[model samples]
Target: MNGMTDAIALALAAVLMAGAPLVLATLGETLTEKAGIINLSLDGSILLAAMAAFAVSATFDSPWLGVAAGMAVGAAMAGALGVIGIYLGQSQLAVGFILTLLARDLAYFLGHGFSRQPGPDLGVWTIPGLGEVALIGPVFGPIFGSRSPVVHLSLAAIFLCWWWMYRTEGGIRLRAVGESPRAAFGRGIRVRLVRLCYCLAGGALVGMAGAAYSLAVKPGWGRPQGCEGAGWIVLAIVIFGGWHPVRAALGAFFFAALQVSGIYLQDIFPSIPAPVFQVAPFPMMILTLLAANLGRAGRVQDMIRRHPFLKRLSQGWSIDPPAALGQDFDPRKGL
Candidate 1:
């Protein structure tokens, strides 16, 4: 029993560490979408940012500088999307898709020289006293006592975003811009500017996520970088979370749990091909999404209606995206 408990604790710790980047990316997308912009270039952006981060860290021997470089690349890509898609009236989806391809190729081409290079990495920190607590020490120590700063940042981002979105005036304005740009304009909100600001901010966070991969989580860069498909998963998480920061963070942790489970499955079933377990989480996550959406079906609705507790529990899972998501807003046209 004790051994099982220790294993579970260790797995939970791994989940927290592994989920950090996902949480950051998901929160970033959630903020961007809430402000009525879509950054479809996330996949390529992450790859490009990861490459840039590692290259800079190797050159300067400073992980912090690499983080800055990565953030700049992410913000630049997002800014381009905002300028071309939101301001110039181009299709957001088209612009984002093109950027993704461009960024991916750019990363591969420019990063060839830095492939498999050594780089500076962030150090881990552990909180004092927490690990020494009685009874719960063994369980809670790894879960909360020890972690990379980036992991702690991801945790902070979840609550900060939630509080901002639900508690503050700025968040209200931001949401207003997303819900109805024309209405927001009527109320003296600079809709385009607000959207653009959030785009850059969100992109910066996404870039930080890339840095986290190179400097802390994955700890290196190469042709595959091991984080290629993460951006797409981040996008899926944003949708699955209904563009809410807290829910999106939860979605990230859930996916992380699936990934950790995959590793355990591999150990348990050595006969199965490793690739099979590796890819299982992606499909399982999609299926979970399908199941969540089933709440909208008539039968499911009827069942929920009959059970007050179930209805309450289902509320968070059933939500719609922002009204102005992926739509361009022109201030010249009045509400």
Candidate 2:
């Protein structure tokens, strides 16, 4: 029983560690989207930021500095995208796609020297009293303790973002900018400025996630880091989570479960190819997104409405992207 408990506790800890980056990325994207922008360059942004973080940390011998540098890189990339899309009225998707490719290549080029180099590692701080508990201790210890502060930070961010988005007046205004820019403008809100600010802030978080990968989670830079496709996964998670911060964090954990399960299965079934399990999460994520969207289907919604409890569940699954998401707002036109 003790062994089983240990195994379960360790597994949960690993999942939290793995899911931490996804949580940050998903939340960042959610923030961007909530501001009526889509930073499709997330993949590139994460890679470049990771590379920058690794390089900076290696130079400064400080993980925190690396994290900050990474955030700056991410914010700059996002700011450029926001500027072009919001100010110039270019297609955000096209610009974002182009930037992704560029960013990826740049990371590969500039990070060539930093590849496989050791950098400062984030120390795990385990809480003394809580970490000493029997079963729950091991589980929550790492979360609150010193194993990786990123987990705690990620958890804190989810709650903070949730409250800011749902409970505050500023949050309501932010939502209005995304959901109805024209209405927001009519209400004396500065749509473009708000969108730009949130987009940059979101990008900063995404960048921090990139740093979390190198300095904390994986700890070191690789020529082509294994985290290449994580950005896309995070995008799927946002949809799976219905663009809500808490749900998105849960989705991150869900993916982490699938990821850890794949690894565990590989160990259990030695005959199976590792890549088979490694790629399993992608398809599973798609299925999850499809399931999450089921409530949006007319027939399914009708069925849900027939039952009160079912309707509540359906509502939970329903996805309502900001009304003006991806739409340009021109202050000159008062839109």
Candidate 3:
């Protein structure tokens, strides 16, 4: 029984670990989307930032410095995206997609030997006196005591994003660009400058997302490393969140918890193939797609669709995902 409790605790820790990366990335991307731009380059930004962070941390022997360096690289990458998507008039979708490929190749080329490499771990902090009280320590678990710093940072990211989106004047301006760039411009807002700033800021968060993985999560770098996992999931999470920062964090937790549960399933049933738990998640996500889109027309049978209720629910009312996802902003086109 004691062992079982420990295992459950570990599972909880894993959920926190896995969820932090996505929460950070999705929060950054959420801002980008709220500004009416899509950032498919997330995969690339993460990879590049991770590699940069790993290399810097390994060289300097300080994980914190490494993370800052990585954020710089990630921000530069975002600046490039801004140049193309915001200034050069390129399609954000196409540009971001191409950058994804570029980022993958770059990360592989640089991080091949660095894959799974070890680095200094980020420090964890906890409330004083909580350890003496037996109840709180195990209850909060490593959440505040012995876990990675990224977890707290992720939580902070949520509130910071909220502040930036609604509370501050700059935050309000960023949303303005998103809501209607042309209108914002008419009102004297620098459309290009605002988008550019958001892109760089968003990229920095994605970079921090990468740093979270390398320093806090993996504590190293390597081939087949997972900048891809959390970054790729950001798109889904933002949609699941309806483009809200708080909702995005919840979606991140849900996805991460499910992933941790997959491991828990294996520990409980060792006789079962571990690979089943590994591949099962994709199938489950697919099922969720069907369930979430319960009334949407079947892809091949859309023309022959006849379900009145599903059609109505699918039209625009139910839990439909974000509609503006991936669409680019155009001053020429009105929202």
Candidate 4:
């Protein structure tokens, strides 16, 4: 490959690798939201899971075991949130936020000894026949390669989630619960139970995202960790993606591209402050959120739709959060 082509190829590969974690986390959050629950503790969940995955893998010398441990931790944390916030009638947002802080500290403290230590990782795997293809091999090969099977897993997750949320009978019920729990309840669906189930399941996926970071993307754990605020960014990608699994995956890829862009730019502009590139995605995402939500009002949306340029720019930018999202439900009370 030519220099430019190679640079582009590597950049895209980096995107798939970096975005894998966000893809998992975004999908997890999307599933929870689809069931009318918000897993705000995702930020901490990722941190704790990463620590658990790395620490356990280092100790046991088994990456798969570490992944299992990470998923268990994530599921347990999310289950606690469901039982307390959903069943006990506490604020899910408050509980989730507190959990993030606590998990962050716990990961740091408990994982102190494991920092900077080497651990098991999914090394690269080139396809037997396909890896020989001149063009396709280099681009698609790395995604499914053993170095990071999470890329393939993330794609599978997106497909499965999209199918589950739209193509099946159970999916319709899931949406009904989020859109209108009362309506779902009237149809004999257990709203609270569905929400709790999805919440726990979503947390498990988020936990796996953490393991993907340690075992596949970054390898091991240490200070100055880049995984700390990734959960928040993943959450933003969910909103930026309009809560659709596929769109959210695209958003994750886009965000990862931006991160890669910062690195690419550093080579051309070495004088620029490094932190500027690091933090650029944040404001960009905030602006994207503004663009999306600003057109939600009736008149504004209608006006934007009528103008060619404005309509084009505002395409797919509107707010449609689940109808009964975050609202406590009582099946016996009829709402």
Best by lDDT: 1
Tens digit per residue, CA lDDT, model 3, 1-335: 86877767777778878889889888888888777678888988898888888888887898889889878977888788888988787888888889888987998798777666667767675667655677776656545567678888888889999987889999878777777666777888887788788788888989998888888877778876755655677777777666778877887888888887888789899999998987776566546645555434467237325666656644433444334434455566543
**Arranged by lDDT, best first:** 1, 2, 4, 3
How many steric clashes between backbone atoms does each model show? 0, 8, 6, 3
Cα-based lDDT for every prediction? 0.90, 0.89, 0.77, 0.86
Spell out the clash pairs found in candidate 3.
Answer: 114-221, 115-221, 115-222, 115-223, 116-221, 116-222
Cα RMSDs of all predictions? 1.3, 1.5, 4.6, 2.1
How do all models score by TM-score? 0.96, 0.96, 0.84, 0.93
- Please rank every candidate by TM-score, starting with the best: 1, 2, 4, 3
List, residue by residue over 183-276, the lDDT tens digit for candidate 2: 8899899888999999999999999999988888888888658789898898889878878899989999999999999999999999999999
lDDT of 4 by residue, 47-166 (tens): 899999988999999988898888888888899899998889899899999999999999999999999988897666555666567978766554444446787788789999999999
The reply for model 1, stretches above 4 Å from the true place, is none
Candidate 1, 203-262: lDDT as tens digits: 988998988988899888887788889998998889889888998899999999999999
Reference-based lDDT, residue 217, model 3: 79
- lDDT minimum window of 10 residues, candidate 4: 139-148
Off by over 4 Å in 4: 133-147, 297-299, 307-318
